[model samples]
Target chain A: GAGVSQTPSNKVTEKGKYVELRCDPISGHTALYWYRQSLGQGPEFLIYFQGTGAADDSGLPNDRFFAVRPEGSVSTLKIQRTERGDSAVYLCASSLNRDTGELFFGEGSRLTVL
Target chain B: AQSVTQLDSQVPVFEEAPVELRCNYSSSVSVYLFWYVQYPNQGLQLLLKYLSGSTLVKGINGFEAEFNKSQTSFHLRKPSVHISDTAEYFCAVSDMSGGGNKLTFGTGTQLKVEL
Candidate 1:
């Protein structure tokens, strides 16, 4: 697809389970970002990757949340021991570079931790 | 750190009526401002942006916004609206401190355009 692609548009998991969300950015885009949107709230930044290196991961809530962009193309977000509070829509976005303020976002993956 | 505020949680207007959505921001350094629209079950799409140049920026779908540096505000406006314009509008900001393009978004305002 020409836009960012996210897998498992909807996922339902029980608390304490592990989950992994994948994001495939547009080809040639060097900057990828991950955000979480909770009910009635705006999307909050999670992590950002620039060319295979995580430029910033400060937005991550805790150690249980981790992301990796091994090849600078596809990235994955991992959640360990998911809790009910983890339920939200995970959004992935990509930009040509880090400097450009514009970001192309995917439809997002809806995660429901019961 | 940067943050955005959208005072109105929702705006209800009739068809063909003018509408305005307010936005405010707080940041230590200069920043870039943007307005994004999100339809049901879809990701956000850029409606307009204020990078540098002009303060009154025009965007797609007949939407426009004015950047007020002194007030730290970027209010979106449209001369008239249609039913299709009903959607969630988000205001975002990204600081220009060379800290990557990480946007801080407001809670979003749902625009309900009625007939």
Candidate 2:
């Protein structure tokens, strides 16, 4: 693909429901990242993947938020028991490699929890 | 820890007027700085970056930023801005020490270029 792609541009779910957001990074890119942005705030880091392994996940606010990249290309961000506070735009980005290269971001999936 | 601070939360200027968005950072290690623009209903796009050399770095869309190591600041400036340039601008940093692409972003500033 020419750019990073995210599934389900918008997702609305009830409290305590589970949701999964998917991301398809640029072809041959070796790094993937996830971020969350709240209203009137900047995007906050969530997780980073170098291939199939998670190189960094320290930025995740809590264990309820989880992400995985099984084959180093497409990734999924899973949230358990969604809360109203969890409502935000979930952003996915990709880079040429883990060490160097600026990020290319997707349109993002807007999650609204009722 | 790396933290970025955008001095102004909102800035309004007349169309074609020069503008400057302030940004400062605190970090113990060397870092790379970037300026990203987010238009309405869109994701972020890199305007410019300061990786190394030349305190001043030029980016797309006629945007340029200067990295000041002593002041720990990277301020973006443009001689003139258009209505299309009216968008949310973010200042971000990534430490090379981290050896990865983990970015710390500022609170963001809304640039409103009025006619």
Candidate 3:
């Protein structure tokens, strides 16, 4: 079975530019989540989606970060104004549902804001 | 809010030697505990979890963790570690208050198994 898949294994962009990272969850998965991992740190939660609606977006760093899962399958994390501080590995994860608690994670999209 | 802390930033052990990675969490309500491992250039993988029942929870790749509610700790331990066990280990906590599935992760402990 296919695990969570993230596009553009690596991306480098200029500061103050806009960027979009995509995630493809496992087939039949109803829950999705986004996280960011900085150097020497663990993955930090960013947002969570249950079906097509976002259940929690409190982890998002600021207003510049937003995510959407309109069809309940694929999700997109958009950064309005990328900053050098935004450089990190963006990770996506999914579960059968929120209750199971076990989340399958994707290889991740490494974003480098220069 | 809940938070996790992995006491050691790195742990180096010889092959076939015992090792333990300490983790502590703070939360006002009931919470679930988990341990995740990440090999170089790979995604995080679940090693074990402690939701309820007994304190000792066994997980993949010959690992186990003891959940001590009183001490607010869930430390991972392995009797004998292999060179393959070299990786970063993260401890996370999720409580009932928040979207039960949202996990708060620790900085991570790098396990370097030396031969």
Candidate 4:
């Protein structure tokens, strides 16, 4: 794709179930990021990956929230034992590198917990 | 840790009127500032950023922002807004350390441009 792409534009899951959202970043982008946006709120950072390594994951809300970017080009955010409060629009973004400061964001995956 | 604050939750303006969205940040270290816009049912798009050099930065769609270090502010402005400019505006900040990768965003300010 010419820009960052996210899969499952909308996801509906039951409480206590698990879900995984995927992100495909722009080609050659070495930095990938994950964020969550609640209704009427701005996106909150969850994690950031530099190549195949997660350079920052401090923003992850809890142990249940995990993300992986094994190939550095594609990433996945996995949530275990999801709660109703965990529902939000999961956003993915990528940049040429952290130094550039401009990030290209995906359309986002809206996760609804029922 | 860096944080951003957007003072106004909503701003209603008539078409062709000027609009300003205020943003403030708190951080001990140097930081980079950015403004992003979100149209209805669309993903966020970068409006402008303040990385270095001149404090006043121009962006797409006739939008601009001024970075003020003393006030720790980056406010977006447009001299004349059109109805099409109605959208949500977000302010973000990132610390200079570690390439300032992670961004802290404000709640957002909704700009309602009416006829």
Score every model by TM-score.
0.98, 0.97, 0.98, 0.97
Give candidate 2's error at residue A110 in angstroms.
Answer: 0.8
| Local error of candidate 1 at residue B66 (angstroms) | 0.5
Candidate 3 runs further than 4 Å off: none
Give the DockQ-based CAPRI class for model 1. medium
Model 3: colliding residue pairs: none
lDDT (10s digit) by residue, model 1, range B1-115: 9999999999999999999999999999999999999998788888999988989999999999999999999999999999999999999999878654799999999999999
TM-score of 4: 0.97
Counted clashes in each candidate structure: 0, 0, 0, 0
Q: Model 1, range A1-114, lDDT digits (tens) per residue? A: 799999989999999999999999999999999999999999999999999999889899999999999988999999999999999999999999677678999999999999
Q: What DockQ does each candidate score versus the true complex, computed on alpha carbons? A: 0.71, 0.69, 0.73, 0.76
**Tens digits of lDDT, candidate 3, B13-72:** 999999999999999899989999999988998999988899999999999999998999
TM-score of 1: 0.98
Judging by TM-score, tell me the better candidate of 2 and 3: 3
By lDDT, the best candidate is 1
Candidate number 4, chain A TM-score: 0.98
Q: Which ten residues in a row have the lowest lDDT in candidate 1 chain A?
A: A95-104
lDDT of each: 0.94, 0.92, 0.93, 0.93
- In model 1, residue pairs whose N, Cα or C atoms come closer than 3 Å (at least 3 residues apart or on different chains), thus clashing, are none
lDDT of 3 at B43: 93
Q: Give candidate 1 misplaced runs (Cα > 4 Å).
A: none
TM-score of 2: 0.97
